[model samples]
Target chain A: MPELTARAAPPLAHHFVDMRQQTEAARLGMWLFLASEVLLFTGLFTAYSIYRYLYAGVFEEASRKGVELWAGTTNTFVLITSSLTVALAIHFARLGRGKLAAALLGVSLLLGCAFLGIKAIEYANHFHEGQLPGKFYTFAEVQGPGASMFFTLYFIMTGLHGLHVIAGMTVLAVMAVRAWREEFGPEHYAPIEIAGLYWHLVDLIWIFLYPLLYLI
Target chain B: MPNGEHQTALEPHHGAGRYVAVWVALCALTVGTLLASRLSLGPPWHLLVALAIAAAKAGLVALFFMHLWDQPGVNRLVFATSLVFVALLIGLVLLDSATRFPLANPPNERTLRFEPPSFETHVQPGEREQGEPGAIGRPPARE
Candidate 1:
């Protein structure tokens, strides 16, 4: 219940020894959370590797038929750009430049939306071409053994990623609102940084996904 | 100072330029991976190269953008542990596949059902089978 000077530091929780300890603890918790997230995605990646190994030819052909190169690449750029903006937002938030941070966050949110928009377009294309998962798949270009399995894996992996994008966008929106309200500053912008970490993870997942689903 | 509370400097060197530079590198790498995929590296090498580029890109984002470089050792360890486990999962499965007979691979279910089963043989016409196994190639009821 000690009164802190205006320029000193944010009020630390009762259990924390110092702002440094508290921040580190919070950050470590976030990293652990991220680690768990990585583990969750690992299951899908394992499924992908096993299926790809078993049905190499069918998977490769399905990649070509089910996914559009231009759309996937465009979304990749969009997501990577969003990661940069989020990183910059965190950078500015640490400098106590709330407006700049908010602006950059806004940009990142737009790019996130744009990525989803492109994904939706790709999904629509899949629907039109009858390239669906499992038994619903009707695409004739790549039919036969393991064909449905490829689309099944494709829809599951990317669909999960798309959901993450939506979640990231929602988080960015909340952060953007807070940043615009000047809630973050040099002494206390850990939330912004943590959210940026999350957004970057989303981008990171897509970076690998682009090549795996679209290219190889 | 204030109630024996330790204060850490929250402000690091704010370099927008570094972020911009990293962003450029990431984009260039994306394009590079795309170009590499277009090459006829063939089979394992093609996959290996593409994955290497992805790992590099993921590292750049994690170390630079996610501030893992500045993060404490504990956080880094936690992250690295996650990656190691992923490697373990993939590596062990791949090793099993590589070592196993081609037809004996765990995922190769076709070997179990290589021949199409006759449906008519499982259930006779106008014969109401009670408590008997329904599927073909299955053991008879043990009454």
Candidate 2:
């Protein structure tokens, strides 16, 4: 039996006809917000592309010389795994397994912290090495123009991403609290669903960021 | 807006096992992309290959993990429309930058050249003097 018709329409916000309509509106709203988020990141991506194009060789050398490739790969794995856990959390929420969902979200939140921890280590390494962006850049390994530009884009893109991680963790924490309180169940887990979507978006951005910043 | 019942019917209830499967696939693709970067394809091919793999991984997360696969078409269109506009933004910038004349481009060590010597500079031995008959870029001498 489908869960949709299992009970009368869950609590409504006055305008919605039923629970289904509410969920649809919630999802649509989230997607639209995601679209705006995409555009926000596109500006940084465009800057990265333009700079890389103008200084192809310099960008390659700077990335090779300054970046810790293995660290980046580790963070990539961490974020992807967290994405999996968060998805599982939502699954549990929909099944009315409140404790299990809460636990999964807790793990996801911890992994996000781990990611930021690793990122801080990387940032400290760069700072100590004088790999600052633009005029502040002083690393001697890569010489000539555009080296600073690489780090500039690097810090800006990853810095913004790190902020998103923090934001997602906060949202997940809220979801975890609600799950523990039994606020979400088989029929009323839309908040968890949307939070999961936001966390996935964080992971999705890192998916692209990994290649653009670390690999190529 | 569709009613609650219709949206509920549309909701997919794929089990945790299926989500795990997508997760495994995403991890494999990540490894594939990392290895692909090590290949010596060079330039656009390497970049394109890596981005293609990333896009594949992102698509999996969006469709399965984010439940976009179960959502209505309007939701999908909103997201896809954003991507189309992004493409337009990047495409226009590249078009403008890629078609400029070489001299008009940014100054870099790659484009530097030594200035050509003028006619007043010391001429090599056995070279015709400036203004001499048949000399290039010199006025013809009176017969």
Candidate 3:
């Protein structure tokens, strides 16, 4: 192990031998939580697969006719950019530039809001056209037994993802406040890094959702 | 912990430039997928191509943005296991459906077991046959 530097370490938890062990434990715990999140989305993806496989024509028609591809593409770009900013926030935090880190996080938060705004527009369009889930579906352009099922999955999957975005934005907002307070520095920025992991996961889910739902 | 040794053994700190480069790559891939969708790849090819691009984009986000590239083996294991279960769930279910008897799956619209009632043909309860036993607004027949 590398020798400890002369600077005072953060207070080690009573249960851990050193700061390194505690940090590792925290990271591992976050990964475990993220794994569970993956499984949660996995179930929904499986449902999408089954329906798409059984009603291939319906999904194709639904994607081409109902969904707004431009919106999805734009949101993908926005999220990818936001992911970069959040990653940069962590980078700046590690360099002891807390203000810069907070600035990056603030940008990320704005991008997240933009994402939600675009989604709201799309949802409004769907609502106006009556392209809703299950029995609420009324758009008549695409017709088949599985037509409603497609919209149902689309709403459920994307709705759940949007909720995650809100959660991620909340986390980023808090991290931004802390970064602004200069609580994160080279010696301790795990909170920022962990929060970044979550925001990236939200982006990761959207990456798959775009092609599956919008591109078909 | 020494400030100098603060860097974890597995997780290397990447600079801002690396993140920007990944972001650019992700954006490019997003555009690539969008353009690919316009192609008349037909049925399975379209889905395969789109999913492949999505997977690539997701991989970039996870490895670079999420720092899985330099993460410890245990964290990687946790993620990989979750992915394994995902694959199993989708794969096995697809296999079952694919191998099922033709009649087990919903019949194609053209071959539906019964004709669905259209709005024009839908009957109102008030318009049902009058005086029929047990009909709406009518009394039941005695045994």
| Residue-by-residue lDDT tens digits, candidate 3, B49-89 | 99999899989888888888877568888888988998999
> What clash pairs does model 3 have?
A5-B2
Per-residue lDDT value at B13 in model 1: 53
Comparing candidate 2 with candidate 3, which one achieves the higher DockQ? 3
DockQ in order: 0.35, 0.36, 0.36
Error of 1 at B109 (Å): 11
What fraction of the correct interface contacts does each predicted structure contain? 0.70, 0.62, 0.76
Model 2: residues >4 Å from true position, as ranges?
A: A1-9, B1-10, B108-143
Query: Tens digit of lDDT per residue, candidate 1, span A43-97?
Result: 9999899888888887888887678999999998999899998998887776566
Better of 1 and 2 by DockQ: 2
Docking class of 3: acceptable
Give stretches of model 1 more than 4 Å off: A1-9, B1-7, B105-143
Ranking by lDDT: 3, 2, 1
- Model 2 chain B, TM? 0.67
Task: Kindly give the stretch of ten consecutive residues in candidate 3 chain B with the minimal lDDT sum.
Answer: B1-10
Candidate 1 DockQ category?
acceptable
lDDT of 1 by residue, B20-114 (tens): 98889999998999999889697898888989999999999998999887765798999999999999998898777767755566444454445
